[model samples]
Target: MGEIAGGIATAGVAVWLIALSACDIRSRRLPNTLTLPGAAVILVVAAGTGHGLAAVAGAAALFGVYLTVHLIAPAALGAGDVKLALGLGALTGVYGADVWVLAALGASLTTGVLALCRRLRGVRSTVPHGPSMCLAAGLVVGLSATV
Candidate 1:
């Protein structure tokens, strides 16, 4: 029963991520409607699964890190990316710290690749970041299942 519930919650998170990523790609912004409620749902589900406090802490920490980066280099990161990271952190913490680390690594690698591609094409680099987030989320979820 617990496993089944976890599976359902994970599926919901994936769907939510897909939708949020698409919206962010189109608008260059992640609406609060998507991020806030998604984070709330993850928190509630994590609490029910006995991982609430850790998940919340992880989310807060990730948010703080992103916020600091945004403040230091406003042109480098967007507000939507920070909010999305918070949600991803909550999901990862609920699953495990390993998943969180994997997600972060994945996002970083993807961003680097995109920047390189932009440079190769002689285009000004401005990644949407949503696709990378979705990629990271998917990788983390898949790795969590296997591990």
Candidate 2:
């Protein structure tokens, strides 16, 4: 991808991710409104731009990872999250499998630290994972585009 195209793609995906994060933060639910359309947009762009097959593999790979956890503890992980992961996996997958690994590891570290903090504070309420996911997505896309 050229400089302008990569920048534009990253920007578009970032916007989507940020909007979804806001919704998730507010409602603790990732409505299909944003995520479904967002996934379509990412996959379409990725396919048209020559990242098609990798994007599919990426989405499947990440979806499976989350599915495993979801199966283990359905209550702890919501379906919305798994759906969001599918979209995000496709997004990160455009770059490569390594990008998905980076995003997952980075997001996991962020979530773990925040969750630990909340536990220490005696705040038992569930923390929304979407924001961390978005943060990781943004970081991966931005970093990959630059490199």
Best by TM-score: 2
Clashing pairs in 2: none
Candidate models: Cα lDDT each:
0.81, 0.85
lDDT of candidate 1 at residue 146, scale 0 to 100: 73
C-alpha lDDT of candidate 1 relative to the true structure: 0.81
TM-score of each: 0.90, 0.92
Residue pairs that clash (backbone atoms under 3 angstroms), model 1: none
Residue lDDT tens for model 1, 15-88? 89889879977888888888888888888877886889878977987788778988999888888888877788
Writing each residue's lDDT as its tens digit, candidate 2 over 1-147 gives 788986787678878888888988898888988878888888888899888888888888888988898899987777788888888999889888788899988887888888999999999887788788889978997889679
What is the TM-score (0 to 1) of candidate 2? 0.92
What stretches of model 2 exceed 4 Å from their correct place? 1-5
